[model samples]
Target: MDRFLSNTVSRIDAKGRVSVPAHFRAVVQKRGYSELYALRCLDLPAMDVGGLDLLDRYEQRIAQEDPFLQTADDMSFFCHGDGTFLKLDQDGRITMTDFIREHTGISAEVAFVGRGNFFQIWE
Candidate 1:
C-alpha cells in the first residue's frame, strides 16, 4: 500500500495557504522529507506533489537519457525549472505561490487526492 493514501479536501486561507493532511505529513516525515516538491501538472489544471522518493525516481528516469535528447530537455525543464519546493509550516500548512494558485485556479477550497507514490491538489 502507498504511504500517502485517501482523499481529503482542505480550505485555502486568504493567503492561499492550505494544510497538508496529517496522514500525508506523517508519511512524508517517515520518509525523511522536510518539503514537498510541487509542479503544475501539465496534463491537468492541478498541482502534482511528491516527496524525496518520487523526485529521486524522476531524476533516475532523466538520467537514463542523453542530456542532448529532446525528451530529456523537456523533462528537465518541466521537472526542475518549474518545480516549486514548499516547506510545511508548524501546522502542516503551505502557502501556495500566487503564480501556482492562479495557474491551478484554486480559490477557497482544494481537493487533495492520493495517487500511489504521490498526490495531487485540485481546485
Candidate 2:
C-alpha cells in the first residue's frame, strides 16, 4: 500500500492542474514527501515522477560514475538540473509545468502509470 501501483488517467482543469491518483498520493504522503520530483525520461516519451528516495537513487548512480565522463554530466543535468518539483495542492493536485507538457505532450488528460517507487506521466 506504500508503493505506487496500477494506473489512472486524470483530466487537466482550466488552470492546467491535474489530480494525482489518490493511491499514488497516499504513497507519497506515506513517504513524507512535500513535493514530487519529475524528470523527463531519456529513452521514452514520458516523465518519471517520484519522491526524494527516487532522487537519491539517481544521485547514487551518478556518484558511481566518473565525474569527468560526459555520461555522468548528462545524467546529472537531466536528473537534477532539469528536474521539476511538483508540489501537491490542497486538493492533491499539481499544476502542469510547461516543461512537463512539452516533454510528455499531455493535453487535456494525463495517464499516471505506477512503477513501484515512482510513476510515469504519459500523454
Candidate 3:
C-alpha cells in the first residue's frame, strides 16, 4: 500500500487551489491513480482525502459489519457517499470547489496530515 506519510502546510491560492505535497502526489501516482477523492469529514471538521482503493477497502469492511451495529447508519448515510473527485492538474494541484471549501472552513491555508492509508486536510 502506498501510504501517505508526512505533515505539510500549504497555502491556498485565491482560487481555492492548493499544491499537494510532493511526497503525497508521488505516492498516489505510484499507485496508478491520477485523481483524488475527498469528503467533508463526518465526525470531524476536516476533509477526508484518499484514492479509489481506499474507498473500496472502506466499503468492503462496511459490507461485513451488521447493518444495525453501532454507528452503522451514520457510516452508511453520512460518511459514506460518492465523494467529490478531482483530477490532479499538471502541477499536482487540485482546486477545491465552493462546497468543499465552505464545509471545511478552509481559507488562506491548510494543514495536510497523512494518515497512512489516507490523509486529512484541515482548516
Candidate 4:
C-alpha cells in the first residue's frame, strides 16, 4: 500500500478549486486514489479529509461501541456534514465547494498535509 505524503503548499482559486501540489498528487495517484473524499475536521477546525471511506469506517467503529447520545456531538460534526467527492482534474486541481472552503477556512493559501492513507486540506 502507498502512503500519503506532502511537502508543499497550494493555492485555492476564486472558483474554489485548489491545485494539488505535484508531489502530493503523485503520491495519491500512486496510492490508486483518483478521487478524494472531503469532510470537515472536528478536532482541527481548519482541516478536512480526502478519504471518506477510511473516515466513515473509523466513525462506524466508534459508534458501535459508544452510546448515540454520548457521541451525538461528534457525529453531527463529522458524519452529518456534506461530504464532498472530489475528482482531481487533469491539471492536478480539485474543486472545493463554498461550504467546504468555509469549513476549512480555505482562502488563497492552502496546505496539503498527508495522513498515511489520506490527506488533509488546511488553511
Best by lDDT: 2
lDDT per residue for candidate 4 within 1-123, as digits (tens), equals 366675467777877788987777777777677687777676785555555566666577666754556575556565655576778889888886777677877778778888776678887
Stretches off by above 4 angstroms in model 4 are: 66-77
Model 3, 17-59: lDDT tens digits are 8999999998888888878888777787787888887677667
Q: How accurate is candidate 4 locally (lDDT)?
A: 0.71
User: Which ranges of candidate 3 are over 4 A from the true structure?
Assistant: 65-74, 79-82
Per-residue lDDT tens digits of candidate 1, residues 1-119? 33779999999887779999888888788778888898778789998888867677778999999999899999888878877888999988988787677878888888888887788
Model 1 misplaced regions, further than 4 Å: none
* C-alpha lDDT of residue 41 in model 4: 70
Residues forming the 10-long window of minimal summed lDDT in candidate 1: 50-59
TM-score of 3: 0.83
TM-score of each: 0.90, 0.97, 0.83, 0.75
lDDT of each: 0.84, 0.92, 0.81, 0.71
lDDT of 2 by residue, 7-87 (tens): 999999999999999999899989899899998887778999998788899999999999999999998998889999999
**Where in model 2 is the C-alpha error above 4 Å?**
none
Backbone-clash count (model 4): 0
